[model samples]
Target chain A: MEESLYREIEEIIEKYREEETPLLCVLQEVQEKFHYLPRNVLGYIAKKMNVPSSTVYGVATFYSFFETNPVGEYVIRVCKSTPCHVQGAFNVLQALKRELGLKEGETSKDGKFTLEVTSCLGVCGVAPAMMINDVTYGNLNDERVREILALYRR
Target chain B: MAKTLKEMEKAKEKANLVTIYLDGKEAKVPEGITILEACRMEGFHVPTLCYMEGLSSWGGCRICVVEVEGQPNLVASCVTPVREGMKIRLSSRAVREARKTNLELLLSNHPLDCQLCDRNGSCELQELAYEFGVREIRFGGERKTYAVDMSSPSVKRDANRCILCGRCVRTCREVQSVCAIDFANRGFDTFISPSLGLPLGESVCINCGQCILACPTGALSEVSHVEMVWDAIEDPGKFVVLQTAPAVRVSIGEPFGLPAGTVTTGKMVAAFRRLGFDRVFDTNFTADLTIIEEGHEFIGRVKKGGKLPLITSCSPGWIKFMEHFYPELMENVSTCKSPQQMFGAIAKTYYAQKMGIDPKDMVVVSIMPCTAKKFECQRDEMCASGYQDVDFSLTTREAARMLKEKGIRLEEMPEENFDDPLGISTGAAAVFGATGGVMEAALRSVYEISTGKTLEKLDFYQVRGLDGVKEASLEINGMEVNVAVAHGLGNARRLLDQVKAGNSKYHFIEIMACPGGCIGGGGQPIPTNLEIRMKRIAAIYEVDKNLPLRKSHENPAIKKLYEEFLGEPNGEKAHHLLHTHYMPRERI
Candidate 1:
């Protein structure tokens, strides 16, 4: 509800005013700016675009990439696809969970780390892949996963 | 394909006919039509579930799959267009087996508790299961179970019983344009839910219950008040009084095996009497009273330079829609309480005091053809007489079910009139069930009162029928009063948007939330589509024509109520009891 946030949202909405399918693009930009889609911001966008709030919420929940809840300072999405599973992705997931002291989709108490198990990150050639923020780490083992977490912690 | 001699004889109708083989018989049909339409034209009955008549075809449910020649896979006939020389088989051995497999998969995830469901007999999915003779589940699997949502006073949502057909989702978005609910999440976890998975009561749902009518199963239903009514009736110290809405009299017979639109008013009353109600009254009496209040409000607004266009507030769904979407126009809406609430307010004060019955012990039950009435009766302001104005409200379907549970056949019961005092209503009250009935009834009284001359033709044909939006102009006392009538929330939105934009040029408007007014309300009989709604509208008009007193102002009981109790139409006591207020709501 801050003045700056309102002005920024208005600017984002204005940028996609001419696009054919602007809702998802507008939502992605908003999410990128705020780390997640705020509930009140979704309602604001619906009012701005003359669309129902239900529709904005529907599109927001339909895509897994968009998060409605706030993420931690660092998000760890371990790949759980077939190729990664064959390469001991479960061990990598357990390592990350133990290192961050958080279960899947849970943020740590200090809000420093969050762990999630996602589908294929499309780096199956290297297998046992994981994504932190936007960086992808492949051929990951238990020790390498802990080392990656330590690097982020520093 | 082999061309039969009899098929050739049936194909010689038109010169431009296209030839297609249907079930190996060479038949000629029209060009550029879907295979389902072509098959239907050929006198073939192809079963369908998700394919509604007016909606855009969604081939989600493969129950209507048919075998086509040279096609490797069976095609959904509802979405596939027919081509010239296309050979189609509606019921082949392979097609039947594939349909059975598809249904088995749906049933595997579906909970098989039809006996305990609300839509047990009337459900489309249940009927298809019976047709397929699904005895045992060949493909048993883990079923999807969800907690039932009963937060809304009007609707109840059970996600476990949903078939993921998207009928309710489409109906909410396409027909009503409320868009309060939609398909959320991805495959396997996909279910129909309100926006952000909020309870329907918290969402911008008008509680229209059209989704309940569109649902193919028991996933969506009205929040029932049947048991509460039964408990009140069983209490020895309580005097239970019943009031049936005007729309209920015309459509309540559908669940009792009588045809749609059958006017079972007399039998409905008799059934209520047999059900142990001490008094059986009519909501039409208060519907007439609404005319007096709303009509005066309109004239006052026009004369005093108040809000130009006065809108009717009979429908709670429409009232909520206006509150959420068009809050700026709240002043345009008439403050008159709906007939159901008006009847309750009068029943507790005037009727109870007359009979020397204590208001606390008098339980007023309303049998309405609407689900929103259930929510309307529970509003915080409805208790104008210390006790709750209406103790309970039951839908037409619920009332019929209670009658059947008591072993009472509506058709077998003899004709009986509504009880005295509160039961007497005029023809103007009877037409309140249809879409334009409110506008016509108001004009019938308003025109006569203003001009001091009777209307020769009581029927205002211009404002009648199933049109989504209807407009008419009347000259009362040399003043041109332009009026419009809109039924269905989608149409109401369109009309209201025009009004909000300052483009509307009417002095009065009538808006009903359901498509064909209260007769086609959300809680009406199952299969309440366009055709059935039209029949109910016709029956409403027929009831109007047969009555001797055809104007609200001429109703002696209403006149006596004003003479003895409430002094005038918009008097201090009348406004206190008969009028209500509205508040703006969150758009989300």
Candidate 2:
């Protein structure tokens, strides 16, 4: 049986019960456990924490780290900064797109990959880099990107 | 911090004095006061957009920025506390440039449809723009545009006009504790919306309209009923009648050049007549009726072992708040329809039958100092007369706009009287505009009715101030009737929580959603602050003081209403026409 969202939220709330302003930490843990934060889940969290639903929503949406929409098993972020753009990051992005058959901000039909364009991932030394499920791959080319995609696909 | 004026005054006496140099001149101010307050105290003007006096300062809008001699950057004077020997330039060249640039930047994204906006002359952003001489936007690029949300009957949200000062957000959180709206998205794409970006009507919004009042721009305003009212007036088949709330009479003069809280009931009636209403009545008439009916309900409840704490049900906003936040106490809330609704029901049923007119053709328009009254009037249960009891609930502001469009000046109109029967009311009815008024009005009649004695002094001074919550215990016929009055939803929550905890001692509670009752209502006036609320409260008391009839049950019209039309105060006919029910709602 699947674990109930309410029970999960309760455990998260209990973990931070002693902390003041535990909403952000609770929300972070909830998002970590689940790929995305559900609207009803947010409402339930708000009720449990005695915080206004709007305030919770504001905090959740303020930082881009928390995803409100459901994501696939792995989210691929292609860095599109000055250093990466100066390198062959654009071609690397196109190669990854072609390899995955997905557009930016689109999830694969198999629910295994979500492609996204993001700012620098703090790896300017290894330009033309991208991240996949918290794993960073720097100094990428079209061949390297396709190879990385194959590794994730399998 | 939004400290009360009384508290601020008391603090000033004991506050350590600090000397500050203003434009190279030495001035002394209370140490704990903010620079903005200190500046104003010294009779210097510091323009602000996001800073509201009775709300916590966000300091997000840099319009109130002033120069400190040592500080590298201009500080937001509203948030910066006054310090000793600090040099400040209120209107230096650099300060002016910064302010003007900020105003222009705000204008760059905002829609320039000032004349078409409901808050054209009253918009703080527009006022600042004009004052700063911002001729054109210097950085006009990438404007945020979104569809207007007319989802709520009480308020309209136009994202196109929002400057993101967060006054509405702060006011919703601080004043009402509703927190129904907040900034949902990040930079440029950010806009005020309910949780999960739901429309306001779908949220837990109580339709209080405090957000609309706190809004410094056209971003939030009442969903207008002016056009529908005009159409009703023009229709030959429709017999449109007008009813003005007690608060409307006191504050309607502010829109014109008259002073705040000027009694314009006569002139307002005259203007309604000019605007083509068949008859101009007073909600005060039903206010008197409400007291009678509510008093009877309270008496019967206390006597018959029904629900204790029979809360007065005059404020629609408070009703919605009860539905959302305190549904378990639904039985405690008085089932009596508000004066506005009661007037409509009577006008359509008894008055219509008496005048030999079809109820269908009778359009009841109410001029209320409430935006939630719009939602109340349109409730499916409001159609006790086989048609919607009230056709439209126009805000005082909206009614003033209509009068302006019709070229009817309230200041010039003669001191006429509201039409007969339904127009006549007692002094107790007039004070329904102020906080603690309904309780006082109810107490006056409750004491008199229960005791069967002519009370020498009618004034219930115990519950007649602008405190957030007021309590009084009265021995009516040896029955100790404990009562509490709470204005503003935040204050209402405090008492409701006590009831929810099963620790409430009061037998009756009067709750008004707005701060100063209807006088400081969301629909009252643009600048309905602490000063204006007090003035309106004083004016309402003045109206009560001078009236020949000081109590609700003493009104000749109300007595006649029961004698001729309604069988009794809470009789079968009266109950059917004058009562309604509430349902529990999903908070989010």
Candidate 3:
């Protein structure tokens, strides 16, 4: 929305100015900067890249890692895979949901944490694994989920 | 010498002959051709849903699958190329069952309201369902219930009936070079939408209606103004008049079982008169006026050091496209209003004045081979006559539909001449239906007017044909006038890109947004393919040759109009009513 913000996006696109498939790289960098892709940001990216906005929107919405909505400072992804479910992942999710006072896909009241479900973290060796932002929290229980969330609340 | 397609096909077949088996019979065919083409070549029938001619094929719909020996599953024939020693069966029991199942699946998601649907008779999906003998849809589930989008003035978007064939996506992107839509989201929730999921009206859509022509079902169609026209005709207090575009004459006969390129202009006027139109005029009359007006404008720019490369602005689609994409080149487009709008302006103002009628009481309707004309008529700047110039702008297809509703068969109607004053036109106006027609028409007048000589050859053969982009140099008054003609917005983009890069050398240009000009317009009759376009083009040229007056300046009525109402070409009086300006638009 700011002049500087548009200048910053132009810089990010300029990094891949010569790359053939620069759209994915530019979007990845943009998502890292804003924590999520804003609609206006995606539109700006499309204008800078000379690509259609539909393609940009498609790619942004396809990957689960890229969120189109505004997430809190910390995003909690609870694994809902078969291995995690067998290891009481539901109870771990319920503990986090109760602790944060938020349901799935809802951010906390204080903008501290957001909760959502993902397929798997590919760290299935630990069975019941959840991810907070980029860090994986494996072998989680109800008590451990509360204790882990308390640290972010501080 | 260039090789014809037939000669090239023969050479390809001879050079790379491959052994293949078709339904237990051995056959030799060309390699690298698609299995669908191979089957069609061998006279083995195969049904397809997503495969349209002149578009790229991806095996999205499995309805064209065939049984290939040694393969574990049936392969989609539309995307699979023929290989050496391949055995394929088109009508095997397994193949038929798969095709039938796929058809039922498409029907299961689609609403079964064919009787009340807009595309009831002309829908390809309906034809396929009938041909396959689909008794019922067994897989019943939650159908896609997306709301119909009536945001645009010209084309309507009904995603509820979409088959996800992606034909509209391909046509918008590949043919027109307007990437207004693409696949959004993914998998089951995938939808074709404009950039950033905006409504079609707010999006950078020129309303060319190519997507409606590309759609195989009821997913897309022209925003119908037929009811409005009908309501006006039924009102006893209102007087309704009609004008048909030149391109409509060649294609309006198609819906009534006439041939693709039959010139039925006289019968069209007769049908209009029978359908309750008080006066039936030709848009060709204003088309000749455009040649006179735009020709003088070109000469003015060339003489007075105005913007070189004056692009013709007769196509409303091309005008909007120039506004949104190439706004920096706004000065290059001529300020002349399109013939359809020009006819409307003069009809409601000049004609009403001459006939002692009120402009507010008279309704001017235009039947065009363009969907963009609908949007063009409703633009903010079109009401120069203190009222809406054109009351309704209907497509050629819509005009034929109205005739069918009134039981006025075009082929059965007797040939009749158009009314005097505004109905008279010349041969130069007839060529406006085809690509490069405006340039050809302009060159005829520009050459004669500049040199003060009668033209020997009326036809500019170099500017005529089905080529995407054409360039020619005409010597007028000993000055080499470099000119270019581009049809289809994609070709327009290439030529405009040259101008953007400061590499353009031409002094004048003609750009029409639809392929093959207005004959292949977005609002023309259905099944407008390359072959049909060439047929319509040849027929329009024939209409031009058969007419006695071949030049625009020689029209007696036009001279009379100038002497009585308008003083001269490009004069102040004519500028107030016939010329319009453009604005820069934001690309979504």
Candidate 4:
């Protein structure tokens, strides 16, 4: 399995070898091929490219675009920015706490949902918002939050 | 109004102070202060990566996470304000775990090239990663790749190591008011970039480097001349002459395990010698030359009606700022190159002529308390003698690192003097490193020259210390020399704007890029913030007060140099070797 994954990564690298934005393309390809970018695979890519692992790591870490850790089956992110806070995101957060029986920034015991608080979601017009996986839910209320969480539950 | 605890105390009944246990020590703190602030007030040194003084708190790093009684998750003390009857544990297992996890997350993205990193030993991120005992990053992924932006003369930006603390963004907008950089994108794609994707040098960056100081990692660092300097030092064929700027003596001590403001002049001289430099000179000597040239230039401008409000051209940061933000004000800046560059030009020509050494073989290295000096040395017109005047420039921190790498113990070394004529400087020149110092020093020299009478009090108390903007006037030779001093590009802009609006006019102006001048230069040392800058500024004044010759003209070595080599101040010989012209920057 490891050899196959390595070969796949190498093939992806070859496809993006002459691309102007090789790193970006390679990152996307790896993410698609292996659900999450693995540490060994990144190391292998870095070595194959003859680039410093740190430079590669720094690039991976600098942009919020890449995720090092794997998310649960469903990832839930709450907007705790100033505008959202002013619109009572704390109450929505409490509602999430009660519904999931889990605190902020924790994954549910059943591994159905993982919760987090992000900076601004740039949906200030809607005020409080949450993103389940990649889908964003805006103007969240207690009832709406429960209804949303219920859909993600196993 | 911000409604701080101290401010609220005067308006109403004093809010009861709460006692909190920090690392087993009990201390009373104001009720509304954060646990970090409370612990810091109590003198508990909790290592934090993302915390900064006088900025909106953003607990993005989670390095300052602390255990609070009744809280389920570890809280960022920086953002979490203190509450009455709140029990806090700073270094608890859970707190450590959270901090460790956060650091590991940060490290998973961090590049591991510490040796090549400019911030190497002094980086907060590197220090924390070491402290957290993160042997390996359990989770790693695709790294971000961006071209190195070396377009800026002063600062180099590496987005890879950036933790997105927004300190640089906040500092640029709030402190400096030069909104050159901002968060360009959202979510995972988010990164700080100049507006409209302009290169930093082309943007209205002002070259202050406050953002570099604000950045917690090697993501932002001064463009270094270490490799260039090391190469020169290694080549026995080259006569490497090193010059240390005045501000360096006070601030360089911090990196050497000495307290901030500890003046290590003798040790600095010793370190240069130990670094295998052929000669160790003082920028203060040329700083004295600057006064002679700049003072006469100011008087010449005033007498001839050339340009009123003749600004000091010593700060390269300010020079760059003028070129970018206030291109119209370029004519107001003095034609003289900075003291460090002046010394470099002279060392290659005048010093080489005196020593009977070939100018080609002479390698001039300037040790300054400035990152801007790095950009200054690489200027096209700086090479007056058919060779680059300064082969390389080292910051006070870099010099300290070189000393450490060479295994030289500065404190244990015997007191040494700077080599011959070039090394000499007066007290007035020494004070040029502090805020308002150049204004004060130039005033002392200009006042004496103009009036033909010695001033009783050498210190210009009005222009001294760490205020952002300082204004003063003195009647010299029956003419009111209206003067203003500004440190940090933010303050520089405010003062220059007033001048542009025709609100005020002055005979002389002093501006340093970093707050508190060279003593607080971006390249001085890690933790080069306001408090440390103030301490170094105080010590600079103290050094000035203690010296016998408080005026530039009183320096015997300078007088001798003029007598033996150069005929007079700003003379034909001096102009050829000491003075330099400025170039108008093409719009970025």
Model with the higher TM-score, candidate 1 or 4: 1
Model 4 compared with the native: what TM-score?
0.74
Alpha-carbon shift of residue B126 in model 1 (angstroms): 1.6
For candidate 3, give the lDDT: 0.88
Ranking by DockQ: 2, 1, 3, 4
The candidate maximizing TM-score is 2
Model 2 chain B — which ten-residue stretch has the worst lDDT?
B2-11
Task: Report, to 2 decimal places, the DockQ of model 1.
Answer: 0.63
What tens digits encode model 1's per-residue C-alpha lDDT throughout B303-348? 8999868999999999988988899999999999999999999999
Against the hidden reference, what TM-scores do the models get?
A: 0.94, 0.95, 0.93, 0.74
For residues B55-129, write the lDDT of model 3, one tens digit per residue: 788789899999999999999998988899999988989999999999998888788899877788889899999
Writing each residue's lDDT as its tens digit, candidate 2 over B337-437 gives 99999999999999998899999999999999999999999999999999999999999999999999999999999988999999999999998999999
**Per-prediction DockQ, in order?**
0.63, 0.76, 0.61, 0.02
Clashing pairs in 2: none
List model 4 lDDT by residue over A5-74, tens digit each. Answer: 7888888999988988688788777876665555556557766775433334445544443444564667
Interface RMSD of each: 1.2, 0.8, 1.3, 11.9
Could you tell me how far off, in angstroms, the CA of residue B100 lies in candidate 3 after the best superposition? 1.8
Tell how far residue B44 is off in model 4, in angstroms.
4.7
The residue pairs that clash in candidate 1, if any, are none
Per-residue lDDT tens digits for candidate 4, residues B1-588, read 123333334433465787777776776776776777777666676778767875677787788998888889888888887776678888888888888888877777667788988778778888887888888878695677777788887788999878788888777766665666777555565677764355676665766677888998888877767778888999989999999998998888787688988888888788879989989998999999888888888888888998879999998878877876677787888888889888988888778989999999999898888887887888888888889898788877778878887898887777799998898888999999998888889999998998899898887889987678898999987787799999877778888997787676677889888778888787778888767877898889877878778899888987877888789887788787777666565332
